[model samples]
Target: MSLPPPPGTTASGGVPLSRRSLAPDLSRGVMLLVIAIVHAHIFQEMVGGDPQAPGAAFDAATTVFVMTFAEGRGYPMFAALFGYGLARIHLRRVAEGQPWPRVRSLVRRRGRWLVLIGVLHTVLLFFGDIIAVYGLIALMFAGLLHVGDRRLLAHGFTWMALGTLVYAFLNTLPSFTDPAAGGGVLTGSPLADMVTRLFTWPVMTPMLLMTSVFPFAVGVWAARRRVMEEPGLHLGLLRRSAFAGIPVAVLGGLPYGLASAGLWETAGAAETALAWLHLLTGYAGGFGYAALIALLAVRLGDRRGPVVRALAATGQRSMTCYLLQSVGWSVLFAPYALGLASDLSELGSVLVGAAVWLATVVIADVMRRTGARGPAERLLRWGTYREPRSGSATVTAQARSGG
Candidate 1:
């Protein structure tokens, strides 16, 4: 139960956790619901669901709403926050007069641990884990820590274009022809599914890295400015982005949602191109959702009541909460467990995911009041901070858990 250093504060300087920015953690907490809702559908698809399969009108609408609001939006938000969290660590360590090699090694160490955690997560529970991919991306971007914000943005946009083109090309083909292949292995033994994920990691890691670069880099840019930490300083930009980014994102997702819901169907290059359109819009939607959340956090300020507090607490323990979702899904849906995957409708899964997410929030809120670190967060802290001084923790526990 070692506490992390305070957010927006330095170790040597002794900034308290209360001084930390609520926007990032708050946003992450609120967005976890989005992540859970979106991924619930994905988990079903993994266990041999055709979300596009015929269902009731309500199911179709529920599924479509999940796509339009949650799917592509959630991961990118995490990507941005991931880079932002790493950058916060980098800044604090550098301020503490730590050498460059030491900082780089520390970040790399954390990245590797994330991969290990992700491996366990993928093997035992869901095959849709992103932490491993995010870890690899962190490793790749570690060397780019000193790149200027403009340069980072340029590189991010470049990678975004490359990722879109690459994915669009793949989407034009069959769905599983690419990194989408591994989920189908679930039809066999769970051991077989785990084996498939292990084998596919090599390929999927790079693809995930590519698609993730844009948001990660954008996160770097935002981190440099402490945008979320001090959203009030950039209120105009945040407002415009919220206003502008949402509609484009929602509209962009409409076609994909329709396609995924079977309200519209197409094949060949046309389908691929439409998929690309979704990616393009979805990326924007991710940014928009983040901006909107930041704005909401700013408006709520220090006066947020119980709902907000619980969400912020969940956000603080996001890793624990995130892993809990997979745990819940596994118990409720896994073959060796309850095996309800085939039983729940697409809409049903999303509803259950929301319920599970809410339960995790309650759990996280309890953890917060009791000053308990998420099990994963504590482990990650120890793994990344090997040369600990008087305390034990990592940047995430501070930024994420508000330690």
Candidate 2:
């Protein structure tokens, strides 16, 4: 069997497996489940559909649960975690005595690779790829690593307000509000669909980036403060966040959820207002989820139960597992494949999504047992941390000329 990575560093330039903080990984693992549940409904008109449509009571309950707990919340959590990880990497490298310029280069290289991988993922599998959006954010904001705490917070809240406004407006649009305009359907040949995805990716990536900036910024600030890394030290803050944020999110989402479940009828202006409330509160819910998970992680420390281990393993290989989820979705729902998009109800899709996530968790745990790094993560590490031969060569030549 392979051995654990060296102290302080893993192959991916992240914390070593043995040294990783529990909260971030645990939160990521659980957040993937939330993301899966949210994405499951995109192929159907879950919340945007008719308010008077017939459905089972169970399905309606599930719809309410998903809307109030899952929908717009997952992405913000992931975005925050992404920012946290980015800052964590930079901090660790600096602590390890790496130069700032070199760390910047590494960040940029990883971002570029992520963009490429995300584009390919969109073209080949799912259309709603987030990897590229995060990658683009990394590229644009690498310099923020040096910014002060006040500036970082300022930028984060500012972007948060702007992002919420834009997202709220977009959700109020015809395409989102109209049931017929939503849901995924890949018609025609595989190649033809791929071409369509290629076109769609460019337009989608920037829009996603806009929505995510606030969470990402907040994540960076949180990381700088070492919030997730040492949750024990910040119990009061975590508790407050969890207590306040979640209730607001749930209450804000109720109207939309009830309407979507056909339990409450709503029209144009009311629906639009509900959408705004849901999206805005979603950000708070996302942070609350993360904070709550971190608290759990702190409570579960050193215990490392089987379930926790499996979930953390999944989080470590999140990028790979996230892509795998897309593959599963394509096979199950695409018109060229199983074509279950219209056949399956929202509840059914959610079950499938949960199963898919569970499968990845098992796979990830097995890999963890063998001490194997995730394939995508390994590739990213290779690209981001490779030696710069040209720069070294130039240095050597200058030395010779000086001599």
User: Can you list the residue pairs that collide in candidate 2?
Assistant: none
Compute each candidate's TM-score over C-alphas.
Answer: 0.88, 0.88
What's every prediction's RMSD, in angstroms? Answer: 4.8, 6.3
Whole-model lDDT per candidate? 0.76, 0.78
Cα lDDT of model 1 by residue, 1-403, tens digit? 1112335454543334446578888888988999888777766655635443346786789867987878778888889899888877777667666677877977898899999999888777766788898788767788666677667788899989889778677545665533256356454467876787676666556666677889988887788778898898889888877788778878988887888777997777767777777777777777778888888888887886888888888887898899999889877776767777677778778887899899999999898788776889778876775545654455434444332
- CA shift at 261, candidate 1, in angstroms? 1.5
Task: Show the colliding residue pairs in model 1.
Answer: 316-400, 316-401
The runs of at least 3 residues in candidate 1 whose Cα sits more than 4 Å from the true structure, single-residue gaps closed, are: 1-8, 13-17, 46-55, 175-183, 388-403
Give the per-residue lDDT of model 2 (tens digit) for 1-403.
Answer: 1111124443234446767788988898889998887777676443223322235666688788899999889999999999988887777666656578977877888899899889999999978899999899889988777677777778877877777667667766787556654433366478877887888787678778877888988898888778998899899999998999999899998888998777998777777678778878898899999999999988997899899998998888899889888888788777778876666666776787898888888889999999987898877766665556765542233223221
C-alpha positional error of residue 317 in candidate 2 after TM-score superposition, expressed in Å: 0.6
TM-score of predicted structure 1: 0.88
